[model samples]
Target: MGIRVAVAGASGYAGGELLRLIAGHPEFDLVAATAHRQAGAPVSAVHPHLAGLDLVLTATDPAGLADADLVFLALPHGESGAVAAMLPTGVKLVDIGADHRLRDAAAWRRYYGSEHAGTWTYGLPELPGQRALIAAAGRVAATGCYAVATILALAPLIAAGVVSAEDVVVVAASGTSGAGRAAKTHLLASEVMGSLAPYKVGAHQHVPEIKQATGAASLSFTPVLAPMPRGILATVTARPTSDADPADAARTALTTAYADEPFVRVLPRGSWPATAATLGSNACHLQVTADVDSGRVIVSSAVDNLGKGAAGQAVQCANLMLGLPETTGLTAFGTAP
Candidate 1:
């Protein structure tokens, strides 16, 4: 008896990724799929990769998802709140958008300019104090794609007192897919190929989410659109705190944080990671080093922005909610080519 799951906004990339991860999950059955614009069309029309699945493209409705044991909401940020509000209490809900992530309403209003969607337990399983919270939460909100990489790369240092909340900088490059499945001029192949450009500099929405998660009040975060079609590589550099070991502390901090996590791996010293290393997968690969001359610790992180950052993480939380093993369907392996 697999847990029955429903996916709202099923025609999008995050939804398709959720479907892909759950299609073979030993403990889950993907029962319902919804998409507002593509309703009444075959799911394959939007996501050709899911051509053979027995899912229908329907509008997001509470009734269609009534029988689900769990529901994964892949709707756009502002849209999840209304849908989540209508679902039944017993059905566990997991949101892979920004709606329920921040605990502060003011911050939410400032960044998103909307009414606060009540906070849910965050879905980053590797955060030191977060797993227990997720295990007990009935509703969970997955971390933002950029925030996932940013938090994972910086949390350990913050926790270990190796970095302060002031003077931090993060610049991340992401695939166009991270922008979502919508049609936009900038994401067109003609505009994207043979080019890399930065967008949403200091004003990126994920900035507040990152600050809230890492407890870093002063952060300079920027996101760039890379030429590729998947994955995120975030380069973060921060001045070391007075207490930082100054030798192996940066590596030790990250290692200690993810040493036990099934999905996060800190690469061996000096072995730089690449986006291709984590494509089509649910792993977050990272490497950290300290620049003694500048008294700064530089950390680089990679993740399938659509995978471990969004849908794959939604599934991982669903597994926890169902009391099944965390790695039931996800693997740390990456595609090589």
Candidate 2:
């Protein structure tokens, strides 16, 4: 028998993506899927692409999920912590929400306006010394989409002590899917199509997450909504520690950091990362350059917000936690036109 898997919040976009990946995984047996208001409905009713799945949506309750060996919580922020507390400690749990990503309680309360749920082992495997933690922890907190992109863009330079993290700026454009599957007036196609607008400018919740993950001294993050359905393109800039060949240093740092990482790609010189190149896959495309005149290092990174940014990331952590190969059921190649 395969490892029994259960997905909570199955009606949402991240949960649906988890379901898709679980269906394709060889070891995971998707035995239960839960949703809030959609309970008692067929899983296919909300996720048409998963029409072949025969399971009905169950209410998200601990008793209902007790049978599964592994559980994936894709619920909204402020929700997963409670559900996780109710589950058995022996079961592996991965949270794809903001509840447990931050180690500072003050930071979590400031942004989420709720009690801190306590931090879990961060789920970004490519980060230095992070894989070992994820492989041993029973609970993992997947990083946010924007946080992952920005952290991946800057961590190499910060780790190499080549960039001053005191003043960092990140401007990212994300597809509408990052906003979640909820229905809101701002997310309507009529308003979002053919328009590029910025929201949560100075106070995006992911700001502290990036700072915590990369050990950046200070950061200003601005997220823009693009007119597409998936992916995130993040442009990050920071001051370098030295003026001598900062570009070459940044490149060398990135190459050394991700040399053995399967999902992160440092692109060729003069080439830039694009959201389209990472769409529908667990890949993050990165490119870096140094502005000698301005004494700044600029890095561009791209990833599928719903893929590597959320569901794919959660799955990747799960594989490690189970002692399985990191890329067992995940893909690094995007679907091209």
Candidate 3:
């Protein structure tokens, strides 16, 4: 029998992506979908791509989520903790928001300005020491889109002690959808097109989350909005700890970490990952190169911000929690024009 699943906040982008993957999943069933603002409307109205689903949007009621064997919470940050608390202990919860990712309560308060929801099993199975963590926990926190890209690019080097975390710098460009499905002035096509601008330059919310994950206390993170529709291309550079060849060390560490991961691929030397290369895909593409003279290693990572960075990751965690095949419903192919 397939595992019955419910998705809260089903009217948004991450929820819609969950439905997209669930529609074809062999071991998962879409039992319920909830959306507070969109309750009472047909889900197809807000998510045209989900038109074939006969489900209607329901209120974010605990009873609705309680009926499912597994629940995916895709609500905004600071909104999931309360809902997660309300779900039954027997039901596994996979949160796609940032509410449950941080391990330290104080760190949570500093970055999110709210009471900590307490930590959940991190959903990035590709992270070093993450597979065992995911396999053992019931509640999972899917990583932030930007955090996903940045950490995937830098963690290997940091963990291998090849780079000093204090001197790291990450500059990432993401599509408007990363902001969310909400309508915002800056996300407008006319304003975003033909422009590249930075938001939360030194103070982006994801900085603390990134630092916490990679064990970096001092990190310079810059998040920029690219004028595209989907995907993120993160270019991360950091000075190596010593005379260790940055490129060779980065390649070895990253390759060893994700060598067996089904979804993250470390590319061949000299080839780099691009946003266009990973469009509409569940895979995270990575490439590492170094400037020996400058003494900096460049790690470029590409992911569909909505997929590997969000919903796809949520489903991947759900699969681990259920003890099913890891790649059950995810697509590895990127869309080609």
For residue 121, give model 2's deviation from the true position in Å.
1.0
Q: What is candidate 1's lDDT per residue for 258-277, written digit by digit as tens?
A: 87889888998779878999
**Clashes per prediction?**
0, 0, 0
Q: What is the C-alpha lDDT profile of model 2 across 36-113, one tens digit per residue?
A: 889999988889999898999999999989799889999999999999999999889999999999999999999999
State the weakest 10-residue window (summed lDDT) of model 2.
288-297
Segments of candidate 3 deviating more than 4 angstroms: none
By TM-score, the best candidate is: 2
Q: What does the lDDT read for residue 115 in candidate 3? A: 91
lDDT of 3 at 6: 95
Q: lDDT: which candidate is best?
A: 2
lDDT of 1: 0.88
Error of 2 at 247 (Å): 0.9
Clashing pairs in 2: none
